[model samples]
Target: MPETVGDYLLQRLRDWGVEEVFSYPGDGINGILAAFEKAGNEPRFVQSRHEEMSAFQAVGFAKFTGRVGVCMATSGPGAVHLLNGLYDAKLDHVPVVAIVGQTARSAMGGHYQQEIDLQPLFKDVASEYLVEVNVAEQLPNALDRAFRTAEARRSPTAVIIPADLQEEEYTPPQHAFKHVPSSPPSVARSVVVPPDDEVGRAAEVLNSGEKVAVLVGQGARNAADEVRQLADITGAGVAKALLGKDVLPDDLPYVTGSIGLLGTRPSYELMRDCDTLLIVGSNFPYTQFMPEFGQARAVQIDIDGSLIGMRYPTEVNLVGEAKGTLRALLPLLQRKQDRSWRETIEKNVSDWWDTMEQQAMLEAKPVNPMRVVHELSPRIPEDAIVTADSGSSTNWYARNLRMRGRMRGSLSGTLATMGPAVPYAIGAKFAHPDRPVIALVGDGAMQMNGLAELITIARYRKLWSDPRLVVCVFHNNDLNQVTWELRAMGGSPKFEESQSIPDISYADIARSLGLEAIAVDTPDALGDAWDRVLAADRPAVLDVRCDPEVPPIPPHATFEQMKSTAESVLKGDPNAWHLMLQGAKTKVQEFIPNRR
Candidate 1:
C-alpha cells in the first residue's frame, strides 16, 4: 500500500530517469513538495515565484538538453498557469511533463478551494493527459503513459494527482524493470512515392526556374543531405525558420537567413527574389512574405500530409519525408546549367549579408542595448546559454545576437511567453553549470515574475551559488512596448510618447539581496560594468536601459484588421489587452468590465 502519493511519484520519477523538476510551493502541493525534499538534494527541486515562471524555466531546460523538462504546480489556478508554458513546449516539439497537484480525491465531486476544471483545460494544450485518482492502481500506469507519450512525440504530457492522495500511506512499485523504447515498430506501415509525372512536373518547376531557392524547415532534419543536393544542383540558397534553426547553420554559404519579422533581410529579400520556393516541413505562420499563389507552385515536402497548405497554399504539396521525396524527384531534374541567374542571386545574397553586418555595426544611442548584446556574445564563455524574455527584448536579440562560433542560446518558441528567462536561467544553471547562463529580461517581464523569489536564490547563492549564472536586464521602463504598437491602430501615440516613467532600478533591488548589481546607462558604462560582472564568481545582474520602442515582427494592419479597428475608432476606445497579457489577475475584472 502506498502511504503517500508523493512517495509514489518520487519512485516513478526515479524510474523514468527524471533528474530534476522546477516548482513552487502551494497549498495543494505541499505534501508532494515535502516528499521531493526528502530526496536529500540528490535530484534537486528548483523553486520559482510563480507557477508560470516554473514552467518557463523548465522550457529552457528542455530546449538546451533535449530532455523532458518537468514542472510541478498546485491544484486549481496554479495548475492552470502551467498550461501556457506547456503550450510553448508542445508547439516547439520540446519534451516536457507537468505533474500538477489536485484537490483531495475524497472531495473529488465536491467544491474545493483553488479548484477548476483542469482536466479539460490541460487536454487541449498538452499532447497527452493522464489523471490518477486511485493512486494505487492508476499512479504507475499514468506515470508510464505520461512520460512515454511525451518523449515519443517530443511534446508536453501531464499527470494530475489529488493533494490528499499524495499523503495517503502506500508503497509504490519498484524500479527494477528494464526501460524499453516507448515506440514499437509498425509492420503495417509502407512507404510510397509520388507518381512519375508528378515528380517530373515538380522537378520541372525547379529546372525551368532562372532563380531557384530551397526553404528548409524542421522537415530537413533527416533530409540534410537532400537539401544539400538540391542547393548544390541548382546553386540555390537556403533559409530556415526559428524552429528550423538546427536545419542549416547560420554561416552556411547557401543559407541566406530566417524569414518572418525576426528574419534578416537576406532570407526575406532573397526568398522574394526567387520565382520558385521548395518549402520542406515548415508551416511558417507568416505567409505574407511567402509567394502565395500560396504554396501551390512552391513545391512543399512533408511527412505529415495534413500540415501541407495549412498556413499557406501549397502548389505541389508532396506527402513524404524530404529525403525520400527529393530522392524520387532527383531523376527528373535535368542537371541545371544556367549560371547567370544563380550568380545574380548570389550577388544579392552577398549584398544582403553586407547590409546585415552594417546594421550590426550601426551607431547606437547611449542606452542602446544592442551594443551590450553584441559585446556580451563575444565575452561569454563558450557554450553559454542565453534565455530572453518576450516584449522588446525579443526584438533586441532577434536583430543582434550572433550565434556562429562561440555562444549558443535557446528561447521559448511557439507560444511566445514573457517572464521566462529569469527562472529559465536558474534551471539552466542548475542543470548545466559548466555552460554559463545568461538571461536577458525586459523591465516589464521582470516585474511580472522577478520579485523576492529571484533574490532568495541569489541569497543562497551569494555565499555558495554557481558562479556561472549571469543575468542581464533591459531596464527600459516597466512597459510592454508591444501594447503600444497594438494601440497605434486607431490613435496616434503622441500623448503616450512623452509619458515619463522613472527607471525602476532593478540593480538596487539585486544589490539589496546580496548579489552583484550594476546599472549601465551608456555603452561605455556597459563596457566597464560587463568586464567586472563577467569576472564575478557569483550570480550577478547588469540592469541596463534600452530603447523600448522595438518589437520584432511588426504587426500588419490589413484592410480587414484596419476595418476591425475602425469599429473601436468609431466607438472611441482603444484596446487595453496588455493588462490581461501581463497576467494581472487583479485587473482582469476591471480591464474588460462586463456590464450586467
Candidate 2:
C-alpha cells in the first residue's frame, strides 16, 4: 500500500482523520516532504513562517476544532523551536501531536550536522508519550500511540523519526515474537459519570445553602446547558474562569464574568458574599479570588479525580465528565425558592456593565485602550471567534467583550505567553474557514512574533470562505502588563530601558503585504475603523495608538498594591502624573452610581 515509511506515515495520518499538518520545511524532513508530494498532499501541509508558529497554529486548530492537531518540524534547531508552542498546549491542556525529524541512526553517537539527542530533549514537554522510531516496523505503533495518547490525555505527544529510517522501504509489524501491531486509527468514546452516592452528597451540599455561587472553567464547555440549569435552580450567580469565559454567555442576569486579577468587579463580589460554592470543570489556581477558607461549603465536579479537591476544600468531589456528572447531580438538587440572592447578583452585574462603559468612554491622551474592545463588542459578528494575547489588553478582553450568539474566545490562559494571538487567529481560520476570526494583541506581543504571522495570514487568505480576519494591535509602545506588575508587586518604577519598546507602524507593514490596513490614533476613529476593517475583502490589520499610562487595575485592588503603585510613581516613574490621573479616574467608576 505504501512504498516508504514516510508514505505510510502520511497515509496513517489520513486514516486518523487529520486534515492539515502545520509545518516548516527543512532537509531533515526531506523524505516526508517527498512523500507529501507523492500522496498529492492528502493531509495538506500548512507551512508557517517558523517552527514555533507552526506549533501555535496546531494548538489553535485543536482548541477551536476540538480535535487533535498535528505539527511537523525538521531535526535539531527546528525541533528545538517547537518547544514553546508545545509547552503552551501542554499547560493549557490542548491536544496536539508533534512529528519531528532526527539525525540518521548512524549519526546517533557521532555529532553529525543537525544531530542531537531528541528523546531526552522532548521527554519533559511530551511526557505523556515520547518515542523515537528506529525501525520501519516501529513507525505505525509509535505514530498511532502518539495520536491516541494526545487525544486521551489531552496533552502534547511526540514521535521522532530518524532521517535515514524515513526513506527505508515500508514494513509492517508481523505476527512474530517482540513485534507490536497497532489497531486501526480510532478513539473509543465513553461518558464517565460519578457514582450515585457521590452525586447525592454533592447535591446535598449545594441545596443546603441559600447564597450559592458557581465557578466554571474551559473544562465545563460541554456542560454549558447543565451549568445554566443548575444555576437557575439554585438561585446561584455564575462566575467564569478566564479560560472558561465562553462557557456561559455574559448576558445572563446571574452570570458574573471572569474571576481573578483581570476579572470583573461583580465576580469579586460574588465570591466574597456566597456561602456555598459549586465548581465545575475549572482548576482556577488563585485561592485569593475564591471564597475565604472555612467560609463556604463547596462541591467540585471534574472528569479527572486528581484535579478535584486540589483548588478548594470541597465538601464533595465528583470525578466524572462535567456534563454527565452535572446531569446526575441536577435531579437531586432542590431549587431554592428565595430570589433575593439572585436579585442582588443581577443588580451587581448590571452596575458593573455600566461602570465598564463609563470607564471605556473616559478621555485619554490619544485613545483609551478599553474603548477599542468596547466599540467592537456590539459590532462583532454573532459567530466570530476571538483570540487575545497575554498583556494589559487581556484585561479589556476579559472584562469588556460580551459573549453571545456562538462567539468563542480564548487566550494563553495558564501559560500566559506572548505571541500566540495572531497565529491562533490563522489556525482558527483554518478550523472554520467560513467564520470570521479576530485577534487582539498588545504592541509587545505583536513585536515579539505577530508581525511575522501577518505574512502567514496573507499567504493563506484565499483558502477561507469568509475573508475577514482582523489583527487588532494595541499600539501602546510599552510592555504594559509587566510594567504594572512591577509597580504593584515589586514596588518599582518603570525602568525605561526594559519596559519601553520602539513604536513601529504595524499598519504600514500589513499594507506592504497587500492586506487591508487601518491606523487609528484618535479615540473617535475606533468605531469607524472597526467597521472598515471588518468589512474588508481580505485579512486586515487595525493598529490603534493607545495610552500606555492607563492602568489595568484589578477589581479588588489590595491596599498593599495601591501603596506599592504609589511608591513606584513617587520614585520618579516617567509617566507618574498621567498614570496617577488615569488610575484614579478609572477606579472612581466603581463608586459612581449607575446612571441608568
**Model 2 poorest ten-residue lDDT run:** 1-10
Local error of candidate 1 at residue 460 (angstroms): 7.3
Off by over 4 Å in 2: none
Local accuracy of candidate 2 as per-residue lDDT tens digits, 401-427: 999889999989899999999999999
Per-residue lDDT over 259-336 for candidate 1, one digit per residue giving the tens place of the 0 to 100 score: 676666567666666777788877678877665453335687777665786866556768776777889987677667
Per-model TM against the reference: 0.79, 0.99
- Which segments of model 1 are wrong by more than 4 Å? 1-3, 169-209, 217-230, 294-296, 316-346, 357-365, 377-382, 451-453, 456-466, 478-480, 483-491, 494-502, 527-532, 549-596
RMSD of model 2, in Å? Answer: 0.9
lDDT (C-alpha, whole model) for all candidates: 0.67, 0.94
